[model samples]
Target: MTLLAAVAVGLAVAFVSLGAYVTVRQQMYRNLDDSLKDRAVQAANNGVLTNYYNLQRISSDALGLSDIRVGVYLDSGQKVNAKLSPLPPMNATELAVARGTAPDGYSIETVGTPNSPHFRVVAVPARFCPREDDQACDDGETLQAALVVAQSLKPIDRTLHNLGIVLWAIGLLGVIGAALAGNAIAQSGLRPLARLTAAAESIARTEDLRPIPVTGSDEITRLAVAFNAMLAALARSQDRQRRLVGDAGHELRTPLTSIRTNLDLLAQADKRGGLRAEDRQQLLDDVRAQMDELTTLIGDLTELARDTPQVRDAELIELSNVVEDALLKVRRRASGVEWDVQLSPFPVWGDERLLGRAVTNLLDNAAKYSVPDDTAGHRTDGEPLGRVTVRLLDGVLTVTDSGPGIAEADLPHVFERFYRSSEARSRPGSGLGLAIVKHAAEQHGGMIYARNAPNAGAQFTLWLPHAATQSR
Candidate 1:
């Protein structure tokens, strides 16, 4: 930034210096040319070269001509004055003036090389008068000679040189000042950026997720706002991790205690000269069930602990097939409840495994809650007379159970991690099933909703977006 500022300033300064120098030089040359023209008229009228023989003895001051070198060129382009100091060179313009071809004409040019003092030479038609009473000297019809007046340009050159030096110094100083100003702006105007960087580094070292203070509205402030959002997301993730750990520990403790107690009982039986086969078999069955429960709980915890969902392996799949597959899986475990299934072809783009898992959890949850319908009188066979209806149409999946609906107060938190209703406390569950289902639905850009049915049951509806065939 500083370099760019300096370069911009330097270019401006250079342009301004060039324009001013050109204007001043041109104006000075005009003034000099005017003065030289007046001097040329005087030299022509005075017939200065008639005294060329005594020019060495005559001072230019006596003729009121100061610092002027005078030369005379005849009509044949021959110089008559040989005693003039630094006689100006005669070019075509001087010859044209003396030959009467350009009676009122004048021309100007610079004479001499760079190593020597240059002369600003002007050639005008001279009214040559060799004597004060000569008829030809005052005659207007004749061209006798060209009065070529020369003046040294050393002073102008010196002034321009000094001006150039002054402009150079100014440009250099302007560039330096621009660089310093740019640096100062970086220090003060960009102070917020520096503060943000320092805060990020400090957060990295200390592991603190505190938000930075936001002030004013600017691009940097907008960046700070976004950074604060990122920090907030990170903090939420950390909190979720903490809650998951605590909930998982609490849930795992129950199964672990039961397994430990069973093992202790079996050991006591063995130390007492072995237990009966029936007791030993029952103990082994209880231990195996506890281990399975532990495995299931751990798997649920792992599923819920995922930080981000990626659909790189997603496929366009029919939602009906996934529902049918889930229904089959839950049929054996929930055989007591009647399933009323109605499905249709519903194409959706999503991770098949995740979608499949979510569908299964929804079915399992419905079948688990569909208990015996005592309101209609219990069956003599002890099988639940309640029904779990699963219907799919378009991109929506609806599962409703005709057992006990969720309470009005517990409806909102049904899908929260480790959240269980009063009636669900005694049930065999890890309380993470619904949470996993909701997470999958949301990750796939779908949504899930739960509500009480009109009669007496809970209804869960899952909606997914249509498939994007272009992605294929």
Candidate 2:
């Protein structure tokens, strides 16, 4: 930034200085040309180059023509040098003036050696005529000689040299000022970033998940706010991890204790000279049931413990096929219950196994909560028995069950891992099924929302983008 500013300042100063110098140099030359024209006019009228010579010899400064050279170029090929100082050799322009081919104005010429001095000169036409008694030369006569007046440009050169020095000094100062200002600005602008870096480094070193203060409304401030939000999310995730571990431990203990007690009872019976056949088989069955519950709990815990869903070799597959497969598995378990499955040909991209599991869990949940009636018109819940409705339209798959809906208090936490409400505590589940469905939905970039149906039961709506194939 500082370098850029310095470059910009230098360029601006260079342009301004160049323009000013050119203007001043042109004006100085104009002044010099005016002085030369005035002197040439005087010399032309006087005709006595001798008087000007004597005047210059005494004091050119007193005559207001310091270092001003005078000369005459006669048309008859006679030449006279100025007495004030030797002027540069006459060239084509001077010759033309004497020959009456060029007008009188100003011309610059190099005098003497190769590294010669330069002079500004002007020529005025001189008429060759006999002077009258009053000493005024005839103006309308034939041209005789040309008066050439010249002056040294050393003073103007010196003035411009001094101006160049001053301009360069000013430019240098401006560049330095710009550099200083640029440094100050860069420091001020990067202060927030420095703070952010320090905070991040501190977190890396200490592993703290504390939110940072957001102080401004700029992009940097927005970044800080986002950082704070990330910290907050990390805190919440850690808290959830702690709670999940505690809940998993508590859930595992129950089945483990039951299995241990059943095994101990069997061991005692074997030590007492073998137990009755029926009692031993019942004890073995109880142990098997506890083991099965343990296995299911462990499986659900493993599924929930995965940080990300296992979606290996995912591809575009027919979603309806996956749903049909899940329905086939669930229909046997829910054979006694009414099944109202409406499958549609929806195509989506995801792992077939994971998607199938999610669909099966939803069906199982509906089947588990449903209390089937002996009569088709009556339910134990005193509500008319209705079938679980599954439909796929566009990209949305809705599963609505005619069972006890979620309570208002437990609605928000139904999808949370291991979160079982009081009403659902007696149900045979690890409470990870809904969480798995939720994870699958999120991994597929879809949404799952549960709301109670208006007449009865609950409706689970899953919206997956691009689930249905586009119509050609």
Candidate 3:
């Protein structure tokens, strides 16, 4: 920027100075030419063309121009001021004017030396009639002559040289001043960018998500606003990361401790001669159950830990198909609980795999809650618990279980990660099922809500938009 500013200033100064110098020199030369031509004409009209006795006096005193010189020449090569000649020899232009072959002319002359002073010269044709005793010279043809005038150009040259020096000095100062101003402006503009860069670098080095303070509304301030928004998002993501890690660690510890205790017991029993088959089998079953619970918890954490899915790749699939698939799988796993399902054709844009996962989690949670405490009696169809009903219509899908409804106090936090109620703590499942359902619904631009049904059962309604919004 500074270089460009300097170049622009230099060009402007150069052009302006060059134009000024050329104009002043031309005007000066023009004024000098006019004076010299007028004086020469006056000397011719004053009989200096026919008589050359007072040529020097007429040029210096009569013209009041001491630096001016005058001469007269005829077509026959005769000079008026023959003895008092103060001008150079007539060149072709002056000779042509005297001989009536060319018009009046003006020219410049200088000595043969390289640094010789210059002179401004002019020649104009006139009648050179001399007085006689009986008559005056009347033949214009024979009286043809030219008045020649010359003026030294040293003063004009000196003035033009001084002007050139002055213009050069002024132009130099202007360019320097422009360069300095440009640098200052560039520095002022870049100071904010420097702060922004430093803040970004500090964040990169230390993982801080602090926002930069904003001042006036400008392009830089707008950029800072956008950067602050990005920092806010990063801070949110960082918080989610910490929470997921801490919760995952806490959830994994119980199963791991139980498994370790069971292993130690088995090891000690092996050292003290083998236990009874029944007791050994019971210990093995307990260990297996705890391992399965751990596996399930880990899987739920993994599913919940996935970042938002790419909604652009989602296909428009029938949501009922996903729900039906979930019901089929849940029925096989939960044999004691009866299933009541009603599906309708509901088109929605969503990822098939994610939607299916969400539906399956919903069904599994419903069936897990609906099963009777006495599983063998319910399997034999003796006083069976109510069925898990899944209904789908339009863009809404509802799964209701015939179990104790959610507590009023637990309703708000049902979808929170790793959140569990007092009653659900004794169940054999992770608490991330509803959270996953809520997340998947939101990813598809939908929502999930829980309510107590009229049958004293908990009902989860998952509503999906017809067109999924693009996810970040």
Q: Of 2 and 3, which scores higher on lDDT?
A: 3
Residue-level lDDT of model 2, residues 119-216, one tens digit each, is 77677776543332334444564346677777777889899999999999999999999999998987897799899989999988998989777797
Give TM-scores for every candidate, taking all chains together and pairing residue i with residue i: 0.76, 0.74, 0.62
| Cα error, candidate 2, residue 215 (Å) | 4.1
Poorest stretch of ten by lDDT in candidate 1: 129-138
lDDT of 3 at 72: 72
Model with the higher TM-score, candidate 1 or 3:
1
lDDT of 3: 0.79
- Give the alpha carbon lDDT tens digit for every residue of 334-415 in model 1: 7677888899998887788888888988888887788643333234477666789988988889999986899999999999
- CA lDDT, candidate 3, residue 421: 95
Where model 2 places Cα greater than 4 Å from the true spot, the runs are: 1-19, 26-65, 70-80, 89-114, 120-150, 178-196, 214-223, 263-314, 349-353, 372-386, 467-472
What range of 10 consecutive residues in model 3 has the weakest lDDT sum? 103-112
Model 1 lDDT at residue 97: 78
Clash tally, candidates in order? 0, 0, 0
Sort by lDDT, top down from the best? 1, 3, 2
TM-score of 2: 0.74
